[model samples]
Target: PEHFLITLALPAETEVVWVEDFYRGIGDCLDMFGGFLAGGETSGVPSGSAAVISIAATGSVQREHLILRSTARAGDALFVTGTLGGSIHGKHLDFTPRVEAAGWLVRNFKPSAMMDLSDGLGKDLPRLAKASGCGFSIDETAIPVTTGSTVAEAIGDGEDFELLFCLEESRADGLLQAWPFADLPLTRIGRMEEDGKEQALGGGWEHFRS
Candidate 1:
């Protein structure tokens, strides 16, 4: 209670690190906050031989980038884990992260790679491409923007709280057909290919460069 009160007195964007030793006894914390325990099965199936939860939190309003650009591949289909935009209106903080959904995808579909979308597509999509060693071509019309947000806001506005990922081209159709609305609205914005560098077809947002 004291720590909670202290935290309250700190600031709304304060970062708290509850566990310094990830291997110590953070299982309970992970379990409570969308984390699956290692050595235990997730979604009723064992996760090979190596599985564990790790986290790092700090005090500061920092932009988090999950899923990487190095793991994507040519002919891979791109996907967003949940609905896009409107985070400013309240959904970003209240909505659940797509950790479980990502676990399911890794275990079931075995995607080439995955990442959560924190910053808007403008920031994230490029990261995905950079991580996967490939470039992407996004169809602006197919992007899933929030109801009240404009296309630019949906693409550039941070705090959408979604996951943008890529899977083999072959599984794109099946993935959409199998789980249309698994948690948030999913969309096939584009496909991955070898383009030498990352560049958006329409345009994307940039923190330092635009």
Candidate 2:
């Protein structure tokens, strides 16, 4: 009983061979996480229009096991997998998603909240906290920075493709010992709080601000 997935992509105005290559890449990426490429609609733009590719995906998970950012309870321990930051140095395009690791945790820890760190921790963590009606404090010093990456970069550079989750504090020690991936580090960075000052949180995304 796998949580089957269907993904689709449509690339426009490309040769048949190139389209095949794109589909192959998309299939491979989805296959890495027990998913299949289904299909996508195509819309070709006029000449001199910017190149565009559209993709969509759907997945199914049991209602009881579904993890969400808006459900972390105060005092739950926060964690993130793998080192963060410096993805722009090349890791972003080549990073591995923590799909397997997430499944493992679901089968074991039953986290209170979870989400992928697509945006930087600085941006995403606050979102999770806000949605949960709680506040958070992360130790910037404990952020697992990639080699040659600064703590600031780890806080804001993003593209880590890691698992950010919360678990009951009582089970935290067991998690530390029972984690199976020695190659991938699981870091306990912070925790949720009931009465924390939310004013310190900032998104740090520079591109678009309103």
Candidate 3:
């Protein structure tokens, strides 16, 4: 619910009107994020059956301001907001969505490409590269791992819920200087390469087993 709220802000004047869910926490989360609960349905499963819950949300965004994954280009700088890794330890539920930051970026810096890091950097970076038709080279030393979190975990643990974006290399310094959130750590992890090859020093969660 929180993530969806953040995504709605990418385009100008975006607002979430309603959310539907089978999870008990949905109402609380929607309320916390200032979204209307609208309505939803829930059902009980048979004995010994695994419980399943699903959430659906709807919102509107301005067409002119909409950001797309394929908008990245070579020579763009790659950035991630906030720390990563070990989210399962506590940060996952506690972390706040970067709605304001994302809106600021869209309105001011206008990143070439942007996405939220639901999957770990190692996995999602490659996907972003593929989407943009470019390659990326990230610095392992620059990745912001959370306290007590290993670099490997930062690369693969997922659930970071931070924003990952690419912007022209020239505008990076100005964006950093103008960043409003003093507490949030924005790190430049790497750059887009022309080769379109995908490479990462770390690994991330893979849902299916080989």
Candidate 4:
């Protein structure tokens, strides 16, 4: 597994207003590079404590230590953060990270583990399985798609910049109500299981070698 680590140094106690816009730019960079660490630069003002966001991919394919398919707990509810698809339309380069949304989830839902689903669930779910040491059950129709894209295209396309996580089932409703990310098209697509089989229910982008 390889690591795509993004370190951001911003002024301490930064206003909530700018924090999001700041990471959105970073999300843009991630979206541009396919996975991450493809090589790039950072923007925005520099100050205060540096925030490091490490993103990884795990699976049969390896890029140092990025692939980390995690196991899902039986009572865990699956979650997707942010909007999906249509990223190619400046959304990729200008999309906002659900930092506030994620924080809300962490504080409210207490996720067992989390990962950003850049590549579609097709390529990402297996990676998550490897990390959590569990299998997943995907409700394909539950996945949200970008405007003008078909379900097939949305599921298979890469660079969605959405976050996928697992949490106890009982906390699902409260978490959803707390963030209101649903307006952003965030969706609950599935749940975690103790099983270890990797299932590629949706389709995603092809690997460079593939």
Candidate 1 lDDT tens digits, 74-118: 888988766577766766756666656766666567677676667
Whole-structure CA lDDT of model 1: 0.64
Which numbered prediction scores highest in TM-score against the true structure?
A: 2
Comparison by TM-score, 1 against 3, better one = 3
TM-score of each: 0.65, 0.85, 0.83, 0.62
TM-score-superior candidate, 1 or 4: 1
Residue runs of model 4 more than 4 Å from their true location after superposition: 1-71, 88-90, 181-183
**Residue-level lDDT tens digits of model 3 in 1-210:** 213322111222222332123223555666656566555554545555554435466666578668887889999999999999987697897777898788889999889999998888988888888889999888888999999999899998999989999999999999989998999999999999886466645677777758
- The whole-model C-alpha lDDT of candidate 2 against the native structure comes to 0.79
lDDT at residue 2 of model 4 (Cα atoms):
32
Candidate 2 vs candidate 4: the lDDT winner is: 2
Screening candidate 3 with a backbone cut-off below 3 angstroms (N, C-alpha, C), the clashing residue pairs are 156-204
Instruction: Give the worst 10-residue stretch by lDDT in candidate 1.
Output: 1-10
Off by over 4 Å in 1: 1-31, 34-69, 180-183, 201-210
Which of the predicted structures, 1 or 2, would earn the higher lDDT when compared with the native? 2
